[model samples]
Target: MLTIGEFAQLTHLSVRTLRRYHDAGLLEPARVDQASGYRYYSAEQIPAAQVIHRLRELDVPLPDVQRILQTPDPGTRAGLVADHLQRLEDQLERTRAAVTSLQRLLRPEPATLDVELRAVPATTVAAVEATVELDDVLAWYSGAMAELDALVGTPGPPGGLYDNELFTTGRGRVLVHRPVTAPPRTGRVHPVTLPAVELAVTTHVGDHDTIDVTYGELGSWVVEHTLAVAGPVRETYLVGPRDDPDPTAWRTEIGWPVFRLAPG
Candidate 1:
């Protein structure tokens, strides 16, 4: 047995922390003096103390730490820790995305936005579609894309058609598709006929995190050029995550159906 101070020295934890842990029922000492009220811990408790300390360092909640200590199964304890770690990773990625977007927005002289007018012919493709809320679009698209990939393989670079109402009014139809010789109809997947239209097209390079900024730039260009938007926005993923792991190499074409308001 070792005194509280001695155990703290061994574990590199403070005496006050040990007392608090005892009060919280997280790490009770092995024994306590009846008269003078001194806490004592055994060498066997050292490993448990070290584990609690490590968990605390990861910002694990006190209740979770207590649960981990109480649980005897190593796998269960590992799973609890893994779940928290994954949440932290997701939050970190969001933070990184926000920082990247802000950095671009804050640049003194941003790159010029270049656009083109093209007449794209109507075509049919295999697609998975949904009536999704604006806030839920990303999550919905992820699941939809996975389904399309499983059904169609990589027949061609994928594309998505997003309804204007989805952005303007918060809920609308969304379609994720791939061009295939023989479009399959399975589950939510089906063949879609995309009508040809005059598109004011611009390519956005890199992650979709900053794609909205590109959208704003394109909208500004359309207004400046005196054109009226006619239909849902179209996105053609020419070089995407499926083709290259490097986000910088990903190229997406943003197309807006528009007609000239003032003849040139």
Candidate 2:
């Protein structure tokens, strides 16, 4: 038999932690002196103490550690630890994504863009229109684009119209259009005349994660040059996922419907 201090020395766990473990019924001593209230651990308990120490270092919850210790079956004990490890991995991924977003927000690179004001003539298009929640936009867009591609057969680079309410409210209307020589009238694909409008446009080169930064810069330019937004925002995919799998080579034109302010 080894004294509590000896067990602590062997396991490298502090005396205070061993005492707390005793109180928590995690690593009870092999024998306790009733008169002096002293705790003593046997050498056999050293392995269990070491396991507890490692689990705690990994940030495993106390309840989970207790479950692992109380479980007699080796497979059940391993499963408990594995489950917590998986949770830690998931949390690490989320932390990495958040850090990337924060870095983009705080250290923005200087933007050099050419903003143009042009009038787009009315045109007929084969389109898929629907109302979608912001959270579902990505999945919805993927399916919508697939359907449009199958129906239109690569008519032109695909584009989308996003209503202002989509940004203001949680859900709004979205229209995915493909420019075609002759608009088709098929299931969920119909001919629609897109109204003519003047736009303040800028190109977003790369992935959508940082596309908001480009939008902010373009919007600021519009206000500085005295332009008022007129209608839903338009996105023209000049070179996109359909053309290239590499996001670094993707090019999208973000067009905000705008009208010049009258001279005061």
Q: Pick the candidate with the highest lDDT.
A: 1
- Cα lDDT tens digits, model 1, 115-154, are 9999999999999888899999988988988998999998
lDDT agreement of model 2 with the native: 0.88
What lDDT does candidate 2 reach at residue 135?
89
TM-score of 2: 0.67
TM-score for candidate 1, residues paired by index: 0.78
CA lDDT scores, all candidates in order = 0.92, 0.88
**Residue-level lDDT for 48 in candidate 2:** 88
lDDT of 2 by residue, 1-264 (tens): 778788888899988999999998999999999999889998889888889999999999888899998899999988889999999998886676567557766775654569999899998899999999998999999988888888888867889999988888979999999999888788888988899999999998876766777788788888889999888999999998778999789999999999988999
Question: Any runs in candidate 1 off by more than 4 Å, and if so which?
Answer: 1-25, 29-47
Model 1 clash tally?
A: 0
lDDT of 2 at 215: 86
